[model samples]
Target: MNVMAKAEKKISSAFIYFFGSFGGILFGYDIGVMTGALPFLQADWHLENAASLVGWITSAVMFGAIFGGALAGQLSDKFGRRKMILMSAIVFVVFSVLSGVSPDMGEASAYYLIIVRMLLGLAVGAASALVPAYMSEMAPAKARGRLSGLNQTMIVSGMLLSYVVDFLLKDLPGEWAWRLMLGLAAVPALILFLGVLRLPESPRFLLRKGDEAQARKVLSYIRKNPAEIDQELASIKETAKEERQANQKTSWSSLFSGKYRYLVIAGVGVAAFQQFQGANAIFYYIPLIVQKATGQAASSNLMWPIVQGVILVVGSLVYMWIADKFNRRTLLMVGGAVMGLSFILPAVINWMMPNMNPMTIVVFLCIYVAFYSFTWAPLTWVLVGEIFPLAIRGRASGLASSFNWIGSWLVGLIFPIMTASMPQEAVFAIFGIICILGVIFVKTCVPETRGHTLEEIEEQGTNHGRVKASNPEN
Candidate 1:
């Protein structure tokens, strides 16, 4: 009987991790699907000369995400994380189908498609903000980093799947290929919605809502020993009580208060830098970069994204192994240095030998992707999940995620224009500089959050700030 119970508990735990991070699959799929679809869309719609429209088409989703992230944070605070995830899945399914079936009526069709993609972006942004927080709240403190890192793993997996799907469907006649690529997102969205239906509400969220009985019940399924469960519940209740006494409303204004100012800077700064380092330029526009480098047709370059996707998945596996073992700050510093060198080397190589093989740039890009997958991509989510106080975590994470999407939107909107006006090497040099700055930010500002409970981290952040202010000499 005890053996049967242990097996059931293990299965339940696995189920939670799988479904909890499924939103990331949708996030990665939407982002990667565009990389493959854009080439075909350009050819079909006669957008070769329309750099502005192409940029808008690619970035419209990110713009929509800026709003979605803010709104989902507020909604998840009130309606619960599980409901918000369900809402995001529904949004993904409806808009994905709409994006696929957009009327091919010339420039008008491009405008219509932008509108649909923005709606899809709304879902992606919400999932980005909500999933990590949900997973962090539900996971054990010891395993939180690994479980939260699963979101990144699923994200890369989704990207890999989308790339493979695009490669397989590249030969389809007319616009159906891009349409299928865009519409296929509905499959995973549906799966997420159904999977989340069986999941319980987050215990921390339940405790915050003054439902101790339900919180304990939920904790029982996730926690192993009853003693540990009670201890955690007591800690949560105490945190909730303090939050109530503080009477701090969760809002943008609250995030900027003296107490949370530094944390806000660290979280939002890291989130923005993750995008500004130009990884998305590779993920979203790699084929275009390849087309410029090798002078090859975009259709022939589908395999390149698959190669990068493999590297992303492999790097994420490495991250899972070390995430809980090392200080988050230490990993970011090492990753930032490697990532900076990767970008800088490519620019230097191109400058020294302008006519070098395009594969050289591809090799550097693969290196950049490898370092970034384990570091900024996964760790950013982990920090955002771990750094914020419980009182402001949902809204603060939303704001941080908004900054991330905003940076992504800027990169997606401007990269084609930059490439059109300047050398690709110059463009990458700019990102290399940003990567160096990212390393500095990690060293000076970001906190170490390995192996700490969310509540404990919050207290330490608050008290440390107080101590620093009181003892400026230290």
Candidate 2:
């Protein structure tokens, strides 16, 4: 009986991990698909109208992402994670298809493009918030970091797959090529939408709704044995009850209340720093940056993002392996410092060797991306997912994710203008500064939550000054 129980537990864990990561896969595809497609899009649409147009076009989804993140918590709580995911998947697929097939530069096409991208942004934002939260909820304490890290890994893998498709299709030399690249997202979105249909609702979510029977059924599906399911449920229920007692009301202001203030600050601050770290600026414009640096053709530029994507995927895997082994604080510092250094070297190369071989700069950029993937890309998700309690997990994660997208939107909006107006070297140097600040913030403010249970995080979280002793807000 014990032997069979162990096998069943392992299988259940594997299933959760795979599916949890799939959510990130959608995120990755959404992010990377645009890089290659953008160059073609710019040319196809004759997008030289004004900087505002360019900014609007690029930042449109980001703008939508802000609201999407905000909506994730409320919707996930009201509608459930599985249902929201299904709905978002449909939105993602529909928008992806629309984004690809919208007519060229006509009023209708332009309007449709913005609308579709906005919808896509909503899907991306919601997924970013819910995927990690869902993954963390499903994962056991022992394996939570690794499984949640799967979201980041899938995100990178999606980026890689998108880049690969971009490369393969870059030679088609028509608007349809970009369309095809964007439309390809439909395949994964559809697969995920259908795959998750059979998966159980989150046990924690079920428990929250006072549906113990449903929660038990979910636990049974996720665990191998009925006995193990019973044990886990008891533990989870106890934890949930404690969380409910700690605070039952979910609100934006509640996050700023006595007990959860510091956590809110930490969560939101880290999320903001993540984007301010200049990751998206690089991601959004890397292909263009590569083309400028390497003096390469579009096809060649397309290949570099694919290479970068591959490096990011590998980096995420390596980071996942080490995340729980080392302190979260230590890893963040290391990653920030390394990424900071990566940006500096590239800036220096561009400045001192402006006339030197372009390949040298490209090589350094690749190294920078490789380092980023290993550190910030995956670690951020793991940290965010594990740092909050069950009661506030949805709202807190949503708010934090909102900050992340806001940062992304700002960077995406400004990168073109910054790169166009300022020297490229200066632009990168600014990112380096942000990365250094991130390192300092982690060292000073961030707490180590390595290997802690959700219950433990809630207890420690209150100690960080996020919770108040007197007034009740949420």
Best by TM-score: 1
Model 1 over residues 82-158: C-alpha lDDT tens digits? 99999999999999999989997989999999889888888998998888878988889778666766888899999
User: Which lDDT tens digits does candidate 2 get at residues 157-223?
Assistant: 9889988988899889757788898899999999889777666678888988899887886677666
Score candidate 2 by TM-score against the native.
Answer: 0.88
- Candidate 1 ranges beyond 4 A from true positions: 1-11, 208-211, 247-259, 389-395, 451-474
Question: In model 2, which runs have C-alpha deviations exceeding 4 angstroms?
Answer: 1-16, 48-50, 248-260, 389-394, 451-474
lDDT for predicted candidate 2 compared with the true structure: 0.76
Error of 2 at 274 (Å): 1.0
